[model samples]
Target: MSNTPRTLFDKVWDAHVVRQIEDGPSILFIDRHFIHEVTSPVAFLGLQQRGIGVMFPDRTFATADHNTPTINQHLPVQDPFSANQLKALETNSSKYGISHWGLGNPKNGIVHVVGPENGITLPGMTIVCGDSHTSTHGAFGAIAFGIGTSEVEMVLASQCIMQPKAKKMRIAVDGKIGKGVTPKDVILYIIAKISASGATGYFVEYAGSVFENMSMEGRMTVCNMSIEMGARGGMIAPDETTFNYINGREKAPKGADWDKALAYWKTLKTDEGASFDVELKYDAADIEPMITYGTNPGMGMGISNKIPVAEALGGGQASFEKSLQYMGFQKEDSLIGKKVDYVFIGSCTNGRIEDFRAFASIVKGRKKADNVTAWIVPGSHIVEQQIKEEGILDILTEAGFQLRQPGCSACLAMNDDKIPAGKYAVSTSNRNFEGRQGPGSRTLLASPLVAAAAAVTGVVTDPRDLM
Candidate 1:
């Protein structure tokens, strides 16, 4: 091995390069390729059109998510397009000899959630999916990112992808985060500090005490939203927390294989003297439970803060005004006490057990506000089962909230779960882009605690106050 120091991103990416084309993109071998109903059909159809089979079917995993209804999943799908896509995914996966978890399968859930829970996602791997949140897997110290339909077809055909390497950035946060703050808050704060496009053209490595001490689920939450800030992806160096989370999972290595894997994983960290193209740091004490006041994730501020005036914005004035108008708000407005029509507590970003626990903590004793329509969703069936086992379901039921089955419910408008037009929702999902949850539906991205607080109070209340 070379004696030069390397960052974790460099180490993992360098190990995966199949060939570095001179002055062009590198061809990198992919360790995991996750596909869903929305983006895989065209890629598979392309393969059929070309009369080619999947190069390494074992490396690709398929699950019906984007189009599957969260409720009554066992019943036939109602939408023709969604049904067709679901059918196509199953048929294609079967024909390609790829492992598939379709609706009603006990193992089924969002592609990102199922991968890590089943040990299919590992440290130092190169992972890709057609969805942007594929960065969620980067929580394992892997080099993971989203790909387009064409790139998906390419990977399916060769188990390799061609891509230019992204610049490296290290974002380190030191000190203990305040109470009621979460990994979601930390990421939102980071995105607000650096605008939505701040980390564009870079793959980030989160370091320092904050990420190191975060749970694997928390790390996944942080990494899941990396793309929202315009990053190629974001990773956290694997450590004992990662190992323990992966150990004994359904497909994790066992016995001697576990020993070997653990040994390798332990080495998946940045060397002391490694350098990054850009570096930034934050103090954890400054972060608070956060919420997005405008359309984009970067429009976030502390829960207690007011929306900035147009003059204060300095740039993007027109876009900022448009975002606020879309959300039915004005500059200098305080989001606190604003009426919320809906609340969502699940997605690949914050649908883990811990997020549910946080939501439950805030709602355990409080009843749901009569004006709020709340959707409690789990990331996967496994997480749904976890909610039931941990009594979260009971707490939710008592609080007048219903637990929807998994499969990316309310994160997007693809499935039956959608926020009505002209309504405001406080969501735990990653993005708050206009109509992201549904057409003309204003979304306020926040942590589960914040969502829960809003759910119970029917307003954008501070989770800290509830806590």
Candidate 2:
């Protein structure tokens, strides 16, 4: 309706529009561009071919994450391909004069984690990276999304990318969440309810009491998984929670600038009468600690529930059968008591300090299952430091679990922390696609609490049961 006010997405998108073409995409200015080793090499090569320097080097930040080894990062990278990619990133950042946080640097960590922790991600900004998880920055009310190598080049050359605006959707989860449930569980439940492609062509805004009660770290975990459900991105409107989280961060504004920024951020919410192209609502009490049974994130269920029979799946039965076949599962089989070979509790999705604390809470006095190989990684050096200061590392060690260095370890098989072939892992990462954790490795995505339950019992045990 013409009388309806603009939503958060409209305000941010309209503010960043550099130019609107008559019949084509708008040229949108990017406020922050994050580059990681894995995706920036080709884009930098393109820049070299064009002989064009980066338009705004100050707007871009580079880091080595996907290809960085979690262990012995002080030593030289062992894999030749990985070593070259890291080297390329260093070279490109140096030549382009962009700020880079390489291995051994105090700020070095996953780009998504490091950006927000260091205040590089601010409210009302347009952020992009070559990685899909860039949507994580949207927790601060920013318009952040993933871009391809070509789009990377476009941003580097002109600080702008041509893009069509996404339709708006609002997903509201209300009521009090039950015990043992985490933000990871909330997002997983949503994806399972709507299917993987449910939010396609839309930018989603999360609202209601559930998100309002969540900490900044918890909110990041939910927004980080937006890409898994086929949404362009997801965000939460800025409020006191957002302001408090950003106030004293390293890159956040200071003094008068802080006051000015806060005033503007307060106005970034959807108006009372704002209309959305689509809307979804859920009751928080209905969600439980969740886990995936098949190869996709949407193929998930509450930990206490049985997998749906083929007739219950909306997709083609053949495809559903193939997913089950790959996961070594039969229709309607319960996941409880199923043996697990590994348990990984880190990733952009659930690698924050809160995630570590949750895992430590579960494994404090219990020893890990002898058959389970548990990899507990922090998202950043700051988180790693916090774990030590909070004594979480000591509790983990006493429980027979090792705390690995900061990096995107085991989330993907890119680094040294890969699950062996044919092994099943209970992972807290976003994706569980075929071979996502390693060649022939089967991934059952779950919350950190669920992963902790698997680590201690060596099976797909319900977290609530352990509680």
- Assess every candidate by TM-score: 0.99, 0.99
lDDT tens readout by residue for model 2, 221-336: 99999988999999999888888888899989999999999889999998888889999999998998899999889999998899998677768798889999988999889999
* Angstrom error at residue 26, model 1: 0.3
Whole-model lDDT, model 2: 0.92
lDDT of each: 0.93, 0.92
lDDT of 1 by residue, 64-165 (tens): 888789889879999999999999999999998999999999999998899999999999999999999999999999999999999999999999999999
Q: Which ranges in model 2 have alpha carbons more than 4 Å from their true place?
A: 1-4
In model 2, pairs of residues that clash are none
